[model samples]
Target: MTQTSNISRRRRTKQAKGGADYEAKRAELLRIAAELFKEQGFQSTRLLDIAQAAGLDRATVYYYVGSKEELFHETVEGVLDANIAVAQQLIEDDSLRAIERLKKIFVSLMISYEDNYPATFVYIQEQMHQVAADETAWAQDIMKKTRQFDQILIGFIGDAIAQGDLRGDIPVRLVENALFGMLNWTHRWFVPGKGMTGQQVAESFWSIFIGGMVPARADA
Candidate 1:
């Protein structure tokens, strides 16, 4: 079965057993797991470590979070799904001009990364660039959703070019990849609650990159 189905089953099972308290504890465990994964790479982190950090025995940790992979999924998948959902909503919002939509997408995404705080960065560092084989259901699912997100950005850029909001000379995919590179590279240095907020970062990037993408003035 798919990762979604598997997760659903786990949720149902958890609910059947422990209801709201179970979910609350599981959420806390996932929080601890994300912090561990961020500090130490996934390969080095163990289920036992997460269990210990959560004040639970190994056996009970299994009852709450299952495996390390499941814990990883619990940490990452919600962020991915949320970003994708917001991007889709922005793309469908015809009320805004294409440039406005794209700007909102960039800003919103950066804020999301901030809000998620290291989960998105962990995913970028660990799995964003990997070729998703038929290895695991969650991996495949993440890859698929990631591509959909990419396409949405590309499509929006293409629309901007067609609408004369952006320069038509550059290839759409090139612009898309460049935008992603600019945003994704933040994983290397962006520290939450430090200098420049996510919106500031996004606005700075937009000014630098989108400035180049827009058509030059006739006076110039």
Candidate 2:
């Protein structure tokens, strides 16, 4: 081959290899950036800080993520998707009763929060801030997800009520909102290995959710 032709071939090969390397490094950088974003609020975190935390040049960080806001959104969405998947799996189990399924969902959510405290904290903060800043948009988005989960819980509750397993006087929406409030609050106080396991916390929650908000029957 001519010298110029050989040089051209080497250049093409190098570009191809560099493209592959960039993708791999970009994935790693995104992971590190997510951790940093979770540690510091998205507004407080700087691109250079993320790059430094990821051990990459600032410009290279831009190659992986377009902006800090984009990175923050992606990170929060990834965690939310994973959590929805866990809930979907638990609800799909045919053998478990409605109460049992609800227990699984609560336990799994608590475990997820405990395992990913940083990501969960960031998500919660962003969601709260967004809601406070723009009530309309935030309410719509929150209601969309809330309604989706509410449908699942309502279905289970409806089945239990039909089977005489639970009280029928309570509205399904009320039940769903109450349960969501109780379960979602766990992210605030749930510390792992502080003498209570996720399952134990779940059971305590179930006791309140299943046993009714009011006093139990006297004829036990």
Candidate 3:
């Protein structure tokens, strides 16, 4: 290889390693920001609070994740991106019945909520009114991702209704909203018991409510 070719290869390797280091630091900052946001709320939590939580100076925190609003936006983005990926998987899987896929999504969402409560807390608890008031480009993307989930959810409900799993009489929008309302409200009051797990709680929701929604068979 030419001398310049060897130089280029080393440069690329260094860049890749640098990128990985950047992401790791950014992720750590995001975690600290999420918890502070959940505990004190978006408006109350400032850059200094996040910097202190992450054990860094205010300027160092910005170097890692940007402004407080931008940091919060990225936090919400991570959770929504994960949830969307799971929903996409269930939507594409042909093995599971439509109703079954729907139930799996519920369980996955609950599991996500348990593991990433701070991120979930941001999505469930914070209103984007402040973000919108700021009018930054990052804030603009927030609504798009949120609406994207709503659209995908509507698709799932429509598929279930089409397969005769959900009642056709109910409006699609209402069904979608109702499912989200059930899941989002749980974060506020639902507590897991000693013997029970988040997955079990999710299953219980499916077992109880889905049982009522799905049509009954004549067979005993």
lDDT for position 26 in model 2: 57
TM-score (C-alpha) between model 3 and the true structure = 0.79
Q: Write one digit per residue (lDDT tens) for candidate 2, span 1-220.
A: 4754555565455546678676677556666665776677667789899888888776556546657766655555565567677768867788877766766776777777666655566667565557435556535665566457667767777776666667777887787778767767766776667878777777787787877743235596
lDDT of each residue in 173-216, candidate 1, tens digit only? 89888876788889899988999999999999999997677798
Worst window of 10 by summed lDDT in candidate 1: 127-136
| Tens-place lDDT digits, model 3, residues 55-162 | 888755545554777776666777778988998888788897777777888888888887776667676677645655656676677667768877877877788889
Q: Alpha-carbon error at 139 in model 2, in Å?
A: 11
For candidate 3, the lDDT comes to 0.74
TM-score: the better of candidates 1 and 2: 1
Cα displacement (Å) at residue 124, model 3: 1.7
Among these predictions, the greatest TM-score belongs to 1
Q: Between candidates 2 and 3, which one is better according to TM-score?
A: 3
Model 2, position 16: C-alpha lDDT score = 68
TM-score for candidate 1, residues paired by index: 0.88
TM-score of each: 0.88, 0.70, 0.79
- Tell how far residue 112 is off in model 2, in angstroms: 1.9
- Quick one: RMSD of model 3? 6.9
